[model samples]
Structure formats: structure tokens, C-alpha cells
Target: MENLNIDLLKKIVSTYSPAGNETRICQLIKKEVEPYADEIYTDALGNLIVRKKGTGKKVLLAGHMDQIALMVTYVDDKGFLRFTNIGGISPAVTYSQRVIFENGTIGVIGCEKIDSLKDLTLDKLFIDIGATSKEEAEERVSIGDVCVYYSEVIVDDRHMIAPALDDRIGCYIMIEILKTMKSSKNDIYFVFTVQEEVGTRGAKTAGYAIEPDVAISFDVTATGDTPKARPMAVQLGHGPAVKVKDNSILCHPKVKNLMIDNAKKHSIPYQLEVLEFGGTDSGAIHLTRSGVPSGVLSIPTRYIHSTCEMVSLSDVKQTINLSIKILEEEI
Candidate 1:
């Protein structure tokens, strides 16, 4: 079990699991959770559910398994691959980056000749697989195949960089909580959700199916500490963030307070998040059934949605402690 911590995180980020295609990452997570979970199942929407037996309150913990990706739309006679985004993506960042498909196909994303910077868009982008013609490109890559940023996880000092830390880091937090948790009376359901980048669709389905007493989502939030970044309070290396509000939903007062209290009681570093845009699984989970009180534990991340997403391992460790504290206590 030496170096197991980073190993787990590296595995999560290294796996390919875009919005609708999460089987690969889920398969890796399922193996790790089986030893600690009372029962495990994958729902129709591809959400991986890991249940731990408890007799008191039902607590649902969610972390998405999907990342933003690109889908091949067409292949030209010259062996160029046209694509459309599978989730919210920035065309500004797509130029000159490599992408990998599920079937191990590798291609370099390139852009069409543009007259001006204003004309640069996703439509102007195409992936080149070095094939000589359309027939060769089609043989290796077909329309509808998805690919994510080609990056690997790296750990240096307390910093971790990867392509999909947007939520895989959240998954790592969940896995650690499942392993370190002691005796508790809460019925904990740790669900590795799917298609969050697309629309939080997996969370909506998982929330309806579980309908737990309380829910907490683990996901990454943007940081404003970087030079000339947006005006936001969250910062990398500060601590995990307690969600107050985001674009999609206003966090329930009680659930938000619970997180604040847990962080204080456990002496865990934390921050308050009021993200002006973007949303998490909690945004959808809180609306399921009559309603479910929910909040988010955010890992402050830099350059979110980019190939080199950065996070502090210190903040990540604190997020794990806070999540464990919440799950071990009754609501």
C-alpha cells in the first residue's frame, strides 16, 4: 500500500471517461470500492453506485467521472478530422493540443486558416491523425468517436496536474473517504456519476434513485489567485471550499452550515465559494424528488477545463477529511 494515495489519484485522472463514455474509469473505481462497499451497482445512465451499510441517516456523496471532450464529426478526403465539443469547451485552448480516443487513437488538434483572431472557433478546428487520405483516416477513426485532452497526471511536492482533475480529483477524495471511514450510523452511498460535463444528467438520475436524506458533491472550483484572473474568493492551496452559491443553485443554509461546522470542528482549512458561473452535481441532486438538502465541497483548482489543471494536494487532503467528517455524522 505504499504510495497508494497518488497511485489512486493518478489512475483516476489517467483513465479515459468522457461524458457518455464512462465505463473505463468506472471500472477502475468499482474495483477499489468493492472491498469497502456493502453493495455496488451501475445504473442505466452509467453512474457507479457504491453503498456502505449504516442504519441512521442516508447520505449521498457524488463525484463525476466524466470530463469535457471532443467528438469526431467528419473526416475529409485529406485525412483531417472535423469535430464538435461534447461539453462546454473553449476554442481558444484547443489549438495545437493532442487528443486520444477510447480505442487508443491519437491525433493532433489543428485549426483552419483564419483571417483574424475573432474568427477562431471550434468549427475552425480539425484533428489530424497523419493519415494520407480520407479512407485511411476513416479506417483508424470514425465519426462519433470521442477524445479527451492528452495529458498525464503528475505529482510534484504538494501539486498535482492532470487533464481531467475537474472531477476525478473529487473521485479520489471519495475513494479515500470510503477507505478511511470508521464506524458510522449513516447509510453512505458514494456514487461516481456520469455525464456531468454534459449537463449533470447522471446526478439527476442517481439522485432520483437514491433520494437520500442529505447529499454533498465533491468537485473542483476555479481559483482567482492567479495573476489577473477573475474576481473570485477561492484560491488554490488555501483549502477546500464550502459552496454557498453557484450559477445553478443556491446551497441550502443548513447543508452549507454543516460543512462550515465540520471544517471548524475538525480543524480543516476551508474557503467559501460563490461561483458566478458553472455548476456541480449538487445543483441537480437538490431538486430531485420533493427535495434534498445539498451542498458542495470544492477543491480549489487553477486553469480548470484545460489540459493542465492544477490543484494543491493539501487542499485535496482537507477535502477528504471534511467529506469523511460529514459522512460519519448524522444530519
Candidate 2:
């Protein structure tokens, strides 16, 4: 779409914000949303909450800003850094990949001699920062230092391939919605949450604080489009998906139906998502005090949690349209 901001999407996706370390990206989002929001603030767990004042129902919209990463744990005598995963990092997808730390230090992942691919595991892998000794490696990195995949975003006519698209795409959609919104009757709380890759921790706090009438989370969902991939109903370029159920929470029927009805009423293309093994911020938000109803709008994604996660630009645009429709109406 002509209105899609590719630069903004790249900036948000390239920012280094792994789980529990979201300050850099949080600042970027705050600046972008300040003019559009009536009030904005960060919570105890670093969730960036922007509020658009209204007299109607209080609606909370969440999109996590964190990405999966690796944390340095121990350094070997030969100057290699052994680390553990910060989130759901598969050893198969992570082998021999490049990673960048916060201070701009780049490192390459290597693993010990293994019999076969099946023998590959996180414990056998280490990071090499071109250090010759343990002291040298310590000079560049330290224990508990986090790093994310080092990959540049590639955008074409209809698709985007990049790292951290899992939730950054969701953040991008929310920002665009705020920029384009004219007026609304609901008091909308747009929260760019943190630590979702680990356990949806930020949403737990944000949902409790807002205590909204209904909640909706925006995140990426796995697709079945790839060759020999798992048999999922979602696919790229098919528009956004309204969540029915996932591993963590069954979407509240009212919220699910609202999203579906809005898409139909507006003639916006959408698919019904039943994710077999993942969760979104709504997983935690729905369980807030007194049990608030919550649902999710998922962008169909491929190669999730890898260096080159892919999503359809058209699907993203449609997701934004469907989200705007839901927010503009009574929920």
C-alpha cells in the first residue's frame, strides 16, 4: 500500500530489544506516539502505555516489543562465550548465525563437533567474538549480556523478511493505527509490552493497571505456506487472522466475534487462526482481575523466531485496516 511506512517498519524491526531489555525501542515508540496519545507512560515492568481518552468502553490493545535473544553465561579459556537462550530459540535455526550485542559488538555462533544435525543442542554451541583469551573476550562481553540476530531487513513488492518481525510488526501496526486515528468513543490503551517471548510478563501488569472492558493483542502467527511445513490454516498475503484458540488462552467469544464481524462489515479480508503451540499478550491480559475478555489479531508469519522471519506487506495493511475498524466502533 502507498500509505505503508517501510522506513518506520525497518527502524522498529532493527532496534535491539530482547526480552527484559526494551528501553531503547520503548523510547523510539514513545516519541512516535506522543503526539497522537492523550497520555503516555511506562509501567514498573517497562511496558509503554499510551492512552487515547474517551467516554465509552475502556479498550486495551497490546503488542509486545521484545524479541527472542541469547544471553552470555560462561566464557571458555580459549575466549569463546557460552550462552543460554533467552526465549524459544531452536538450536537448528540458530546454528552458525551472527548475533549483535547492545554495545555494537558482533559475534558468530559456533558449535562443538557433533555426529549429526540431531546432535545439535544449545549446550554445545558457543559465541566467538574474535578473542584469543578469556580476558579478551571479557573485555568485549560479559555474563548476562544479551544479543539478538544480526540480519538486515529485506523488503520487496509484497513481502518483508527480517529478524524480530514476530512482534515488531505488531508494534508497527499499532503505531500506524494511532497516526491515522481521528476520533474514538472508547478509551483505548495501546501498550507496547515487554518480555512476551519469555512469558507475557509485561501484559500481566499492564492489563491489571488498565482493567479495561475488553483487550486485544497484536502478534505474529505461524503459517503453513512453506513446503512440507506444519498443516496450519493461516498463510501469508491472506490478511490478518482473528484468533480462536492457542496454547495459552482461548479467545473470548465476544472479542473474537467482534473482530470477525468488523472485518466482514468492512469487507476487509481476514482468516480465523487456531494456533497449535503459541500464545500472545492476551494470554496474560485476559486473566487480569475479574477476568477481562481478550482476543488477538495475528499477522501470518513464516520462519518465525529465525533470522529471516517473513510476512506479507499486504496482510499487514489489511490487519491495520481491520484493527482501525474495530477501534472506531463500539466494542
Candidate 3:
């Protein structure tokens, strides 16, 4: 955990990049890896692909740069901004949280303070940005501006908690791994894809363009170890979770086994991830061009799709180690 760059990770998770609007977070990622990459560019859909070439096999490693957020859909006569969830969001977790706009405007989100707890819905939520009238709110923010729940990265004991760590932690892993690897036999393509929170969209295009011999994606998977959870096997502080199955795709067995073998060989702890509800960038990568062999290395995350997602720093460090070990191999 000490080896990981907390500063960079914090900056990334803090940036507001809802599904279709991922420019700011993408820019933050580009700045971190631009010098290490041989080629860095954005695709038609604004996915940032950073290529670091080698000679053996083409390997594409993708982590999406977007986070779950809300979009300013309408404004009330009283200047309150009405928003729609931009991605799969938990209404229970988002209530009464502060959110920030792209233009540096700040607001507080409230879901109609109620006496009883079970009566809230997205329809009840509204953002108050301190505007006096509808025209005043419109002047500060437009109809399309996106807002991310405001949160700061905090390191407690051995875990890091912040908003958007689901994939930003994955994004951090990709960025750091590329910088750490000096040489390799594979032509490594590190792509910071967009719109993963909405659907595996950006990686679908970037994966097609690269058409690599192998694909590995870094993202987060839900853990059922939390209290009242619906029974999952993964736990925090365990090493990186290797995706075996999820709602979207059955991971390539060879790739998954290779990752597990590498982790054991290097004494890195890992857990088998079976997410009944979500997917990752590998979902798209596995579907590219006549089918590429792909797998995902995931972090066991808690309170996912919320403003304060938590992941073990130890798991994150192990993920970095396991990925680099895989990249250094011939297969």
C-alpha cells in the first residue's frame, strides 16, 4: 500500500466524469501516463488509448475512465436542478450528499427529508445550488451538465475510501502498471476507455481497433462479505479478485487460470470473483473481432455505485503486482 501512489489515485476518483461526459477524468489519466506511452489518442467516442508497443503478442489492457453520476435534466421554477441518474446508482446511498458540476459550481443534493426511511425515490431528489430563480440556476449550469457526488479519498488503517473507486482504482492500476513496466515482449495497449458505467461501450470500440491476441481488464467487483449482503465469497483485504463469472460474460478460462497461477507463484493473494450483478471492460474485450481471449482482474469493492466506495489498498497493490507479473510473461 505504501508503494501505491495515493495522490494520483485520489485525484482520479475525485474527478467528475459521468458516462457520456468523461473528458475531465480522461484528461487527468492522460496527464499521468502520457510520457510513458508511445502513443496516446482519443477515439471517435472519446476513449483514451495509450499504446506501449512490444514484439511477441498484442495485449490490450483496458480500464474505463468514467464513473457513475447524475445529469442535470431539468430545473425547477425555484432554481433547483433536477437530475437523472447517469448510470446505475443507488438512490439510498445518494440521498443528502453534496455534488459538484463541471463548471466548478457546487450544490447539495437532498431527497425530501422524510419522517419514515423507506419512502424515497429518484423522483424525490433535487439539487440546490443556491440560485434564487430558475434563470439564475440556468445561468450557472446548463441542461446537460453532469454532477458527481463529492467525496475525498481517505486512507484508514489499510483501506482507501472514495467515490468512483470501482473503476478509478482500476484506472490507477492501469496507469501505474504502464509506467512501471520498462520493457515487454508483447505490444501492450493500455486504454483508458469511457462509458463503462453506462455499458461496456468505449472498450468495445478500442478493443476492436487494437484486436489484440490477449486482453485483460482492470475493474472492481462487488463483494458479499459486507453485513446484510446477499452472500458473495469475496472479501476486502484479500488480494485482487479474478473474474470467473459475472452477469455479462464468462471469462476466458486460460487467461483466468494464468492470472491465478501467477498470483500463487508470486505469493500474491487473490480471490475468485463471481459477481451476480455487474460486468467490466472485459465483457467488451472478449467480444472483439472473432473473439479475443480475455479476463478481468478486479478489486473486491463495498458500497459500489455510491459516493463512498471502499476497497482494500492491499488488494489494489496485489492487483498491480499480479498484472505486471502477467505482462512480463510470454503467454
TM-scores, each model vs. reference: 0.98, 0.99, 0.96
As a whole number from 0 to 100, the lDDT of residue 246 in candidate 1 is 93
Give model 3's clash tally. 1
**Model 1, which residues run further than 4 Å from truth?**
1-4
lDDT tens readout by residue for model 3, 1-331:
2388887888888887878988888888888888898898999999998888787899989888888888889998989988899788767888888888888898998777767667788878899999989999999999988888887678876999898887889899998898787568888889888889888899999989888899999988888887798888899998898999998789999999999999999999999988887788888889888999999999888888887789998898889888999999987
Please report the TM-score between candidate 2 and the true structure: 0.99
RMSD of each: 1.4, 0.8, 1.6
Q: Give the total clashing residue pairs for model 1.
A: 0
By the TM-score metric, which is better: model 1 or model 2? Answer: 2
Tens-digit lDDT track of model 1 for 1-331 = 1233887788889999999999999999999889999999999999999999889989999999999999999999899999999888898888899999888989998888899989999999999989999999989899999999997677997899999998999998899899988877989899999999989999999999999999999999998898999899998888899999998789999999999998899888899999999999999999999999999999999988899999998898888778778777876
Clashing pairs in 1: none
Worst 10 residues of 3 by lDDT: 1-10
Q: Please identify model 2 stretches exceeding 4 Å from their true place.
A: none
Across 1-331, the per-residue lDDT of candidate 2 in tens digits comes to 2469999999999999999999999999999989998999999899999999999999999999999999999998999999999999999889899999999999999999999998999999999999999999999899999999999899998999999998999999999999987778999999999999999999999999999999999999999888999898998998899999999999999999999999999999999999999899999999999998999999999999999999999999999998988899977
Provide the global lDDT of candidate 2 against the true structure. 0.94
